[model samples]
Target: MFNVPMEVLFKVWRQKPHQSPQLQTYKLEVQAGNTILECLNRIKWEQDGSLAFRKNCRNTICGSCSMRINGRSALACKQNVGQELEMASSSNNGDVPTITIAPLGNMPVIKDLVVDMSGFWDKLQKVDPYVSTQGRKIPEREFLQTPEERSQLDQTGNCIMCGACYSECNALTVNPEFVGPHALAKAQRMVADSRDTEVEARLETYNQGTQGVWGCTRCYYCNAVCPMEVAPMDQIGYLKQDILDRKDAQSSRAIRHRKVLIDLVKQGGWIDERKFGVFVVGNYFRDLQGLLSLAPLGLRMLSSGKFPLSFEPSEGTKEVRSLIEAVQNHD
Candidate 1:
């Protein structure tokens, strides 16, 4: 089958540095097989010479043309005009199939479709994304990894640093300190490396307050929008489990929160709210500040008549316990 030529309406976001953005519309005659980058190139060359966007290699490998295509972050060089039209047809009931192109989210836009990625790079550095050679003797020869160890790095190794996952991360929207998914994904790569000598230290860094893995909201937007299928959210989960395995519950509030929640669920087939706060935030009456901090929330819950004074196990509590035990044993 041959790709037929069609006229498509392009709604492109236009903006100058430090200026408000606006959608500028253009009509282009394009072939269905033409990639979104190709269409943008033609538009810049023929329709509007002043139109601005970033491109290099005109291939997905460079990850230079990543943008919000039709409200989702993706690489323009990989998405074709036909796919956009089909997607629009399914979601849009308008007369014409329209493609809206805009710069990536959660970053400052430099121009029409170019975003400043300084924060993205900075967050990646915060995770110590590279292997550490500190405190290691000089290798006589090349340090080698077994096939299994090498394979563990395959998924994260594919990340092209496209910023697609970072643009769609919901956690970063509310918490700027939260290291974005792209960074966490790379952090997992470092953790999985056999040659890396800083596993314990890396876990400690990643477990530090909301600035690390604890901050992820697990909205899974990063997993959905990642063109390379890095599944950064899943990587975050791996990091969390690694921390849980190595550290005690009293190490931090986040660690206590997870351990306490699981223990409560196993005990009563649900969370015992009355004990949850005392154990997690209050640190089992060990931390005076933590205990005092829970007072206001506890009083508010009591006033609203939402506080659980008594605990009862749900039906099939044994079955739930068995399931939990099964999963723990499997892990």
Candidate 2:
């Protein structure tokens, strides 16, 4: 019960397309259980009529109210004023607590706290995230799945498409072509669905290059920012596993990366960095084209004094080998 209300200050980001961005502070008296969205509504309704933000479902399901609260991507509709105050206080050594609100990152801000999500949607489409069919005749009845197959869909099916994971994705920042985690997470739902018919074609499409699951840096920020605990990174991992199992494109660099990383880590305590590229990208220097493909980068590294000449076995090889063996055995 919010018997006593507290005055909280929100330093919200303000910007319009083709204009400068700034933080505008609004001090409001908010009740304890009031969500950050409620406080923003109060600010717009009472203090500032010109303020702008996006919201549809006041509940967390619609995911329209996703924004950065205290430098982390979260649903403003789900985070209460009390929790934000605690975070702000702890982060700044117990001074007057101030909430820092900003638009989600990695997308062009269209207006104050509103980002253009055309690219996000485009990437989702690139994955062909929907279930595919070859237009076969419909069954007499519904195409049903067993409980065991259905259970696999549970984790990824909760995605609300909030773009929180996309906002925080490090891989997308590095490679703009990389599909965001939201797409991959939803794509996995279709991948696991027993009713889907075109599983092989889907796997082949996703296995080609950095544009798919391979582009992920595995930073796990997508998992951390997700409000529904969809764990997009884990979903991407599942997609990777599926791709590997299907062997759709075994010669793909993504496959090579996984294969080489494991083999190298097993051989030495860690990646040698020297033999990694030669082994993975160069196909162990066996494929002349692969070796020639890396020639430019290797020459650049050599000229810049960055290329490594030799690598020795790591210090804790035995212990590392045992741990690797244990994990392999468990699997």
Candidate 3:
């Protein structure tokens, strides 16, 4: 006896007896304030008791119900079905608004909407997420931090580990070894905390192999999909800045690349590939292997006369310098 204007048809994928996945569609009338999680619950409890999905703390705190809603990763508990349907309807794709629910990509699916979280937990463990303070007397009550000191860790603490960001990340698509955004963001949080005295050790932990923070492409997908508005991309940027400030030699390659970019923009209005290659290699003979790899392309550019041998600083140098100074001062 319930009347509603909008109805959602969810095309849910479930595992079969042979371990194959199959899609099953279900239609449900949606109330004004109903979420996707609510719709799934109604379908399971009333229509088919065997339906499978995971949910806890329907208020978006548990992060257990992350799935792909219409090809994008979203927390089902936090996403409003009616609103998303409306948005999809308004799009110019001219397709019917049907929610396609699937388990998060790049992880093993356990069932209908559940993914094996062992990978996520394992990555978290590798980062050493907890604070490792040096030998210090125990506090009388609890470890206290100043307001300014506490604010640094606030942004990363908001991450609910929803994995939506990881699901959409392009770096993870290409480089499976790279540590995803959540782990790097967590590492940055601890590094910035004044109470933590093991900053050097933490940086070393984050810089291990090509899978560390330095491998991040700074794409900001993590910032977009976060339901709690935690900017993981910003945290990564902070980590990069911290690395540069420390002048770590292992991070010198990234520093050189960034400097090349800045120098190119300052000297000219655009980037010079020839100069960039030189900057990236640093003493051509030292990186003779890399130089040989790019020899063909470098020769083509040189022959084309597109490569500039020398250039003068642009008039915008002062402005760019000021901007860089502002960022450093603020951080």
Provide TM-scores for the models.
0.92, 0.87, 0.87
> Tell me, what's the RMSD of every candidate?
2.3, 3.2, 3.4
The model with the greater TM-score, 1 or 2, is: 1
What lDDT does model 3 reach?
A: 0.76
Residue 127 in candidate 3, Cα distance off native in Å: 1.0
Candidate 1 lDDT score relative to the true structure: 0.90
From the highest TM-score down, the ranking of the candidates is 1, 2, 3
* Deviating ranges (above 4 Å) for candidate 2: 1-3, 89-95, 133-136, 248-250, 287-331
Residue-level lDDT of model 2, residues 1-331, one tens digit each, is 4647766778899999988999888888778789999999989999998888899999999999999999989999999988877666454424445788999989999989999999999989987777665434654556667899889998888899999999999999989998889998988888888878878888787766888888899998999999999999998888898777656324766787787887888898889898888887777777788888888998999999998788778999888989988976775
Instruction: Give per-residue CA lDDT, model 1, range 1-331, as digits (tens).
Output: 1277777889899998888899888888888888999999989989899888888877789888999999999999999988887776353426656899999999998888888999999999998777886434665657778999999999999999999999998889999999999999999999999989899999999998999999999898999989889899999999999999998887889999999999999999999889998999889889899999999998999999998889989997889999999998998
Q: List ranges where model 1 is wrong by over 4 Å.
A: 89-94, 134-140
Q: Which stretches of candidate 3 lie over 4 Å from their true place?
A: 1-4, 16-20, 89-96, 134-141, 248-252, 282-285, 300-318, 329-331
Which candidate number would show the highest TM-score if scored against the true structure?
1
Error of 2 at 188 (Å): 0.9
Model 2: how far residue 319 lies from native, Å: 5.7
